[model samples]
Target: MPFTFEPLPIAVAALTFLLAGFVKGVIGLGLPTVAMGLLGAVMEPAQAASLLIVPSLVTNVWQLATGPRFGVLARRLWLMMVGVVVGTLAGTGFMQGGHAEQAATALGVALVAYAVLGLTAIRFAVPPRAEWWLGPVIGVVTGLVTAATGVFVIPAVPYLGALGLTKDELIQALGLSFTVSTVALAAALAGGGTFEAGTAGASALALAPALIGMTMGGWVRGRVSEQMFRRCFFLGLLALGAHLASRTLI
Candidate 1:
C-alpha cells in the first residue's frame, strides 16, 4: 500500500532482474529460477510474478523477433503455446488462494525431483497419447510456481531440450510459453481479488531490472560456456531447493 521507492528495494529489484536475465542469457533459460526466491523476500509472490512477466516477455520477444529460426519455430508452435497457456493459468489460479509457503515447499520439492531427473538422465515424455493433455499439466505446475514463487521456466526448458530441438526452436518455445503464461496470469489476477492497480504499477517498475538483466544476459550468452553454466545452474538449483525444503521442515 505504501509507495516509497526506497533505495534498498530499488537496488534489490535491479539486482534480482539483472541476475535473472544473466541466467537466461547464458543458458537460454532460468531467469525466473534465479530471481523468484529473491523477489519473494521483498514482494508478494503474485506481485513478483507480475513484475517479471513484462521483462520476460520482452526478452523472449527479442529472441523470437530477431533470432535466425522464426520459420522453424513456427511449426509445432501451437501445441507448445497451448500447453504453456493452460499450465500457467492453472498455476496462477492455485496461487490466488494464497498458498505462498506451501507453494514454495511444493515447488522446491518438484525442482529437486526434476534436478535429480536431469542428473540421472531419466526420460519422461508427453506420450503419443494426447500431448495436448500433457501440455496443460506442465502449464499448471509452471503457473502455480510462477504465482507462488515467480519461477516457471524449469520444467518447460528441460522438456523442450529433451526433444532435441535446435536453438531456435528452444528459444521460440520458451517465448511462446511465457507469452501464454503471462496472459493467463493476467486473466487469473483479474478473476481473483489480488489484482490491484498499485501492485501492477509496482510490477511494471520491477520490469526494468528484468529487461536490464536480459540485456546483460544476452551479451553474456555468447561468452559463457554452456557446459559450465549448466553445471553451475543445476548446482544452484540444488542449493536453493535444499534451502527452501529445509526452511519448510524447520
Candidate 2:
C-alpha cells in the first residue's frame, strides 16, 4: 500500500535489525533491546517497537521450540506470563496516547539502567519458595516496562537468573518468557492501534536481515571472546540509551 518511510530510512531500519540480530545470536538475547535502542534514535519509539514485533516473535518462537523443557517451564512460569499479558494490556493506552514521547524517554532510561547493570557483576537469586508469590509481581512489572518501552528484560531477566536454573534451563526459560512477552506486546500494540498494515509489512521485511545477522553471529560466537564482546555491547547500549534519553531533555 502506501509507503510510510523513505528509502533511506528503510535501509537504516534493515541494518539496525541485522545488527540487533547479530547481538542476539552472540549473546542469546538483546534482539529487542538493541533494536529498540538504536531504532528509537532514528524514529519514534512506537514505530521502532512496531518494527521489532515480527522478528522478535519469530526468533523467540524458534528459541522456545528448540528448548526441550518447554512443557516443564511453561507449567512453572504460567502465572508470570499471565501477569505480563495483563500488565501490557493495562499500559497500552499510555503508550499509544499523548504520552508516547514520555514512553520513549522511559525506554531510553531503561536501556541505560539495563546496560549499566549488565556491565557490573551484580547478581540476584529467587528462592524456589518465592516463585509463587514473586513471579507474577515480576512478570507484571516486566510487562508494564515492555508495554512502555518495548523491551522485555529488566526484572524479568534478573528474576529468571535468580531462579538457580542450569545454564540450559535458564536459556529455555528465557526463550519461553520472551516468546510470551512478544506475543503479548503484539496484542497490546494492536489494541493500541500502533501496529498497522504498513508497520507490519516493514516488520516482515526486517526479518530477513535479522536472521542473516543471527547466522553470522552464531558463526562468530565460537571464535571470539564472549565476555569481551559483551562488555563492548553494553557500552554501546549505554551510549545509545544516553542519546535517546537526551532527546526528551533537549
Candidate 3:
C-alpha cells in the first residue's frame, strides 16, 4: 500500500521528531520514548518506530563517538546487551498481534515510573546476587517493547543511570542501545514485510529535522544548568506520561 502523505501530518511528524531528537541529544536518552509516545496518537506505532530508527542512530552514534570510555562501557554492558536483544525479540513478537494504544499506555506508565524515581530519590541498586539478572531483565523489557511498540528505552535508563557512570559512559550506553535495537527492529520489520523502500526514503529525508533539533539542544545544554534541565526533564516526562495515559484510557 502506498503511504498517502498529507502535508499537515508529515509536517507535524517532522517537527515532533526534531524536538524529540533535541531532547535526546541534550540529555543522552528519551528520544524514542518521547517521540513514539507522542507520535502514536497520530500515526501507527510501527511506522513511528520505524521512522525514528534512522535519526536515533545518527544522534546516538555521535554521542558514542565522543565517549572516552568505550572499553569500560562495553565490558559493563555486554551482559545487558544480551537482555536487550531478548527483550527486543519478545517485544517484536508481542507487537505482531498487540494493540498500539496499549503499548503507548504502557510506555507512559514506564516513563512516569522513572520520573517518580527521579523525584523521590528511590534507588534500586543492583546487588551482586541480582546483578546477574539485571541485564536479562533490561533486555527482555526492552525487546518486548521495541518489538511491540518501539519505545522501550525509558525503563532501561534509570537502571543504567544507577550504574554511577559518568556522563560519557551514559552517552556510550545510550548509543549502544540505539544501534542494537535499531538493527533488531529493522530486521524484525523486514521479516514481517513492513520495511518499505519509500518509507525508508522518507525516514532518511526526515533526518535533517532531527539533526537540527539535536544541534539546537546541544547549544542550549551549556547555557542551562543541570538542576534546571533535570527539573524540566522530569516534568516533561510526567506531562508526557499523563498525555499518553489520557490518550490511551480515554
lDDT of 3 by residue, 1-250 (tens): 2233788668877888788878876776667777776666677767777777778777777767777887777777777777777667655545557586677687778778777777776655666566567776776677777787676565677677677665556667778877777777877776666657866776777689888988887777657676665665566677667766677666
What's the residue-level lDDT of 62 in candidate 2? 71
Among the numbered candidates, top TM-score falls to: 3
| Clashes found in each candidate (C-alpha, N, C closer than 3 A) | 4, 1, 11
Number of colliding residue pairs in model 1: 4
Clashing pairs in 1: 87-139, 87-140, 91-143, 91-144
Candidate structures ordered by lDDT, highest first: 2, 3, 1
Higher-lDDT candidate among 1 and 3?
3
Greater-TM-score candidate between 1 and 3: 3
The lDDT for every candidate, in the order shown, is 0.63, 0.78, 0.71
Identify the candidate with maximal lDDT: 2
Q: Hey, what RMSD does candidate 3 come out at?
A: 2.3
TM-score ranking, best first: 3, 2, 1
Please list all clashing residue pairs in model 2, or write none if there are none: 125-162
Q: Per-residue lDDT tens digits of candidate 2, residues 1-250?
A: 2226788778888888898888766655778877876776677777888889999988787767866688989999999999888888878855556766776677668768877886999756777888998999988998888887787876687677678776556657878888888998988888777788988998999999888887787566546565665575567567656765676676
RMSD of candidates 1 onward, in order: 3.4, 3.1, 2.3
